[model samples]
Target: MIDLGALAKITKAFKVIDNDKSTNRLSHAYLIVCQDAENLEGYMRYFAKQLLCSESVPCESCRHCSLINSNAHQDVFFYPTSEKGILTEDINAIISESYVRPIESEKKVFVLSNAQTMNAVTQNKLLKTLEEPPKNVYILIGTTSEQAILPTVKSRVKKVEISPFSKTVLINALIDQCKDREKLENAVACSDGTLGKTLALYQDQNLKNVIDLGIEILTKMQSSKDVLEYSTKIIKNKTDLDQFFDVLDMLLRDTLVKECGDQSLITNPNALNQLQNANFKNGALISIISAVTDARKRKQFNANQNMLIEWLLFKILEEKFRWQKL
Candidate 1:
């Protein structure tokens, strides 16, 4: 069950949904937009419970809410798809079953995950339902990229944008799970401000280890004559390269924040000693920050990961020394 308490990002969306339920104007289809697709499904399921609750709206005490929370509700249909995404057969089944009357509740909600993977053909098939949905049925589509969904499908559904929480907001939400203030802060930094990503990094020991190693390499890069030497070994360790870059981003961001006299705002405030005495000035720090942003953005286009890592590291070194030879 998703803790509705932590869903601060989409509180307004909840209000709108609640209003629709009260006024009996609930839309038949909804599109949830989020940067993290997996977590987006949680939000969708919670909304389904709200829409289908029997005893009271979103009342956890209701049997309908209980069944849905456990993912056993007959009225709530969830599409099972992971990295490969939804297929044609899945769409066909949904289209076939969408019109069925609800078994236990007044509404039947079809929750689909990773809408981006649905090819044009499958999406076109599903469009029939969205165009003319059943009276007692609702469809929830979750996707990280709204652009990936057919624009026609997008037009028929209510749009809910899930924004990433700020560092303060995220820490307040996760402080109970992690008592250590420093660990919590690091978790927030490494998570890029998403609650799901923060919890995942916090729970994964290997990701935590990579974060420490990435930070070590970053410290070495600050003073080492051969920054590329450290960066080369990291690029070689391809197993946890994604988490490594996330940590690396934090390190560079901390450096920039320190140079700008805002160390208090950085993720690793404990590293103030190292950040304060770093050799690079504001210009170099900004260049490194920009480079990290570019690398992250290019990841979506399936850029060469190894070469991209190598390129960003070299860019950091070049920027760091560009001002020193004067």
Candidate 2:
């Protein structure tokens, strides 16, 4: 069995679960939700190992341990989104697997990663399975947000919150992944306390490049030509466009903070002077924030990327130009 010694919150949660198991009062299902999807994987694995272990502590050397380690355990089922992420078929398979008897272990463990991706219909289908969980079975539904889960389903399962990691923890995790200084800082700022995203940015060189471009676009709000040129880079990558917007928003927020003289919270300390010089009044800042938010929403509905860029750039230019003229 893997020991959950690294994460303090996880260990504490495990203690509660362990107490219940010892008292013969284990819950049928659990819902682990967090903003950081990466942490959820380790916590889930540790919990699954404990459930599958024959001893009080999972002996990582046992036969069951070998199966779990080798991922040969007949009873432990894991479901996640394929290339497209969670789908209806994935949910159906979980429902089907729940009925199967354990091949060797005393109990079965079902792990549903990104359970928040379940649509309304799939969620309803899973609710039925939760209502009547099989004997000697445990279901773990992993989600980024409890709100994504249906209210009925959320009510059925016990909830555990996994908070996002601190910037220091995220930075240490990114050390192996980040090579460029700009990418490192941008990833740390954009991850919003999620180590998984930071590592992903490190591994996916393209994403790091996009974030670097995003920073350039936001920080260099000098000329109208510069604005249009940089905005185009952000609009080019459809995949990372959402994250690009997040970075842009953060940059604007930092500029706002600097304008308001809140230097303590500035992430881009090196660019604070430039940000202060470009700072808009509260009204202009709010307007631009709203515009960026709308642009993000437009992205969700297959909005035209080029026109979206034109719209946002024009909006900002109009606001800033108007402010300068006044």
Candidate 3:
């Protein structure tokens, strides 16, 4: 279980929900949208404890909280027990079971994890129950994609948007988990505000190698002739290619910041010397950033990996030399 107390955003959210419950204004249904699905599920369980616990503030030591923490609660139901995600059958089960009285607590909590996986048909099936659930029944739907949910379904539930943590909050939360300060900073820089991705990047042993390759490309691959060799070294696999692109994009942006004489805004502070020595002008950095964005888009659309890498490298070199000649 995630230490929800350590997460600032989640702690704030808990207070908001607690306030609602205190004022007797709790919504019957809530739609929580978060990019980090795994952590979202853990949060939902904690939310369940918030609703079911005997104490005004959830005493994690209580029977309700302990049952929820252990995933042994009789009243709290988590859907998509299989990797198949929330299906029509799961919706049917929820609907049928929601009408039943709670055995352990006054309120029955149903959580649908990965709610985005439910297509139009499944969502439509869930629309009625979502609109008017049984008395003392609370439903929580979590999705990474908010746009995928039907407008009617969205309208019925209170939308809870979980924003990414600030640099300070994330760093504080991860301090004890990761002892390496430099690697932790690098992971946080690349995390884009999501804790799951931050932890994944922090634990990734190959991340340093990927960053080194990105630096090599930016500082050493000066000529168009170097594209092929660099491309081969960068494109080990799709995942590695994506990581390389992230590092390259980050480094280029940091170099642009350095060029603008704003050292404070640089994400890769440890690479300051390299960024300082990088001779690429503002125009070149901007062009390279655009190329990286385009390349990432192409990658998503299943573009030929080799050709895409080659094209991106050529564009980077072209922009670098073009601006230098000016």
Top TM-score model: 3
What ranking emerges by lDDT with the best candidate at the front? Answer: 3, 1, 2
Candidate 1: tens digits of C-alpha lDDT, residues 241-276: 667667777877777776676645877776545455
Q: Per model, how many backbone clashes are there?
A: 0, 5, 0
lDDT by residue (1-326, candidate 2, tens digit) is 21233442334456666776788787888887767676666667666776767665666788777777677888887777475556778768877777788888779898887887788988898888889988987988888878889999988998766666565555555565465766666666666766667666656666656545645554456677766776665555554667767766777777777667557666655434445455466667668888999999998999988888778777776776666566
lDDT of 2 at 18: 72
Q: lDDT of each structure?
A: 0.74, 0.70, 0.83
Name model 2 segments beyond 4 Å from true: 1-25, 34-43, 50-67, 72-75, 79-107, 114-129, 144-151, 176-182, 206-240, 258-265, 268-283, 321-326
Better of 1 and 2 by lDDT: 1
What are the per-model C-alpha RMSD values against the true structure? 3.8, 5.2, 2.6
Pairs that collide, model 1: none
For 124-243, candidate 3 gives per-residue lDDT tens digits of 999989877899999988898999899999999988777887777787888887889989988987777878998999999888777777777778887767998888766664447788
Candidate 2 clash pair list:
1-58, 1-59, 1-60, 81-85, 81-86
> Over 4 Å off in model 3, which ranges?
8-16, 54-57, 236-239, 259-265
- Evaluate residue 59 in candidate 2 and report its C-alpha lDDT on the 0 to 100 scale: 69
